[model samples]
Target: MAEPTLHIGRKISKVRELKGMKQETLASELGISQQAVSKIEQSADVDGEALEKIAKILGLSSEAIKNFSEEAVFNIIGNTYHDNSASLNYQCSFNPIDKIVDLYNEKVALLERLLQAEKEKNELIKSK
Candidate 1:
């Protein structure tokens, strides 16, 4: 069987989407029109120089963009989230409520210091 052709444009589009970018945004970055970007996204292949520019805008190497796979990305994300040894934990080690209370206490302490300083200024004014 003949090897299937790689849709470079589609890979670029998927990478752009994964990066939360719009075609208009990519167009602006490339100094091209939105229609041009759309056309590129629909193309089966892209030239090396244009591909380099797109890869740069997407914050990846040309090879990375060329080899981009949605399945690989999802697999990595899934594994990262599921593997506790992967150091990608989202759980907070410290209590958020405690942190909020600490911030509130600091603000209160600052206000108290300001109030004491104002009282001192008032006492000085009275003596004058």
Candidate 2:
């Protein structure tokens, strides 16, 4: 049976896709071939050292990639947008849509900060 833990390779692939990056780009960053990146993404497990390298290339922490969850993402979006207090009042043709875009941009920035803090904590723990 599978351990039900996060598959590191799959998470890597997901992040790469969300960032609009191709396997070849990741390979170039890692100084490996596209085929190598594809092979790496096939395995369920990646070495911790290699994972760290991949994380650096992907602009994420190794721990973040290992612990990434889609539910948490949806939860964030739901929490941010589901608040009626923050809801936009649409009186114009484009204002409401622009407000939606603003909300998403704000949420993405907030998430980035949180991710950076998590990375710092992980680094601190590693140094301890």
Query: Which candidate's lDDT is highest?
Result: 1
Kindly provide the TM-score of model 1 when superposed on the true structure, using C-alpha atoms. Answer: 0.62
Write down the RMSD of candidate 2 (Cα, Å): 21.0
Every model's TM-score: 0.62, 0.61
User: Which lDDT tens digits does candidate 2 get at residues 72-121?
Assistant: 76787898786465557634547788999999999999999999999999
Candidate 2 lDDT score relative to the true structure: 0.87
Q: What total of clashing residue pairs does each candidate reach?
A: 0, 0
Tens digits of per-residue lDDT, candidate 1, 36-79, equal 99999888888999999999999999999888887899899997
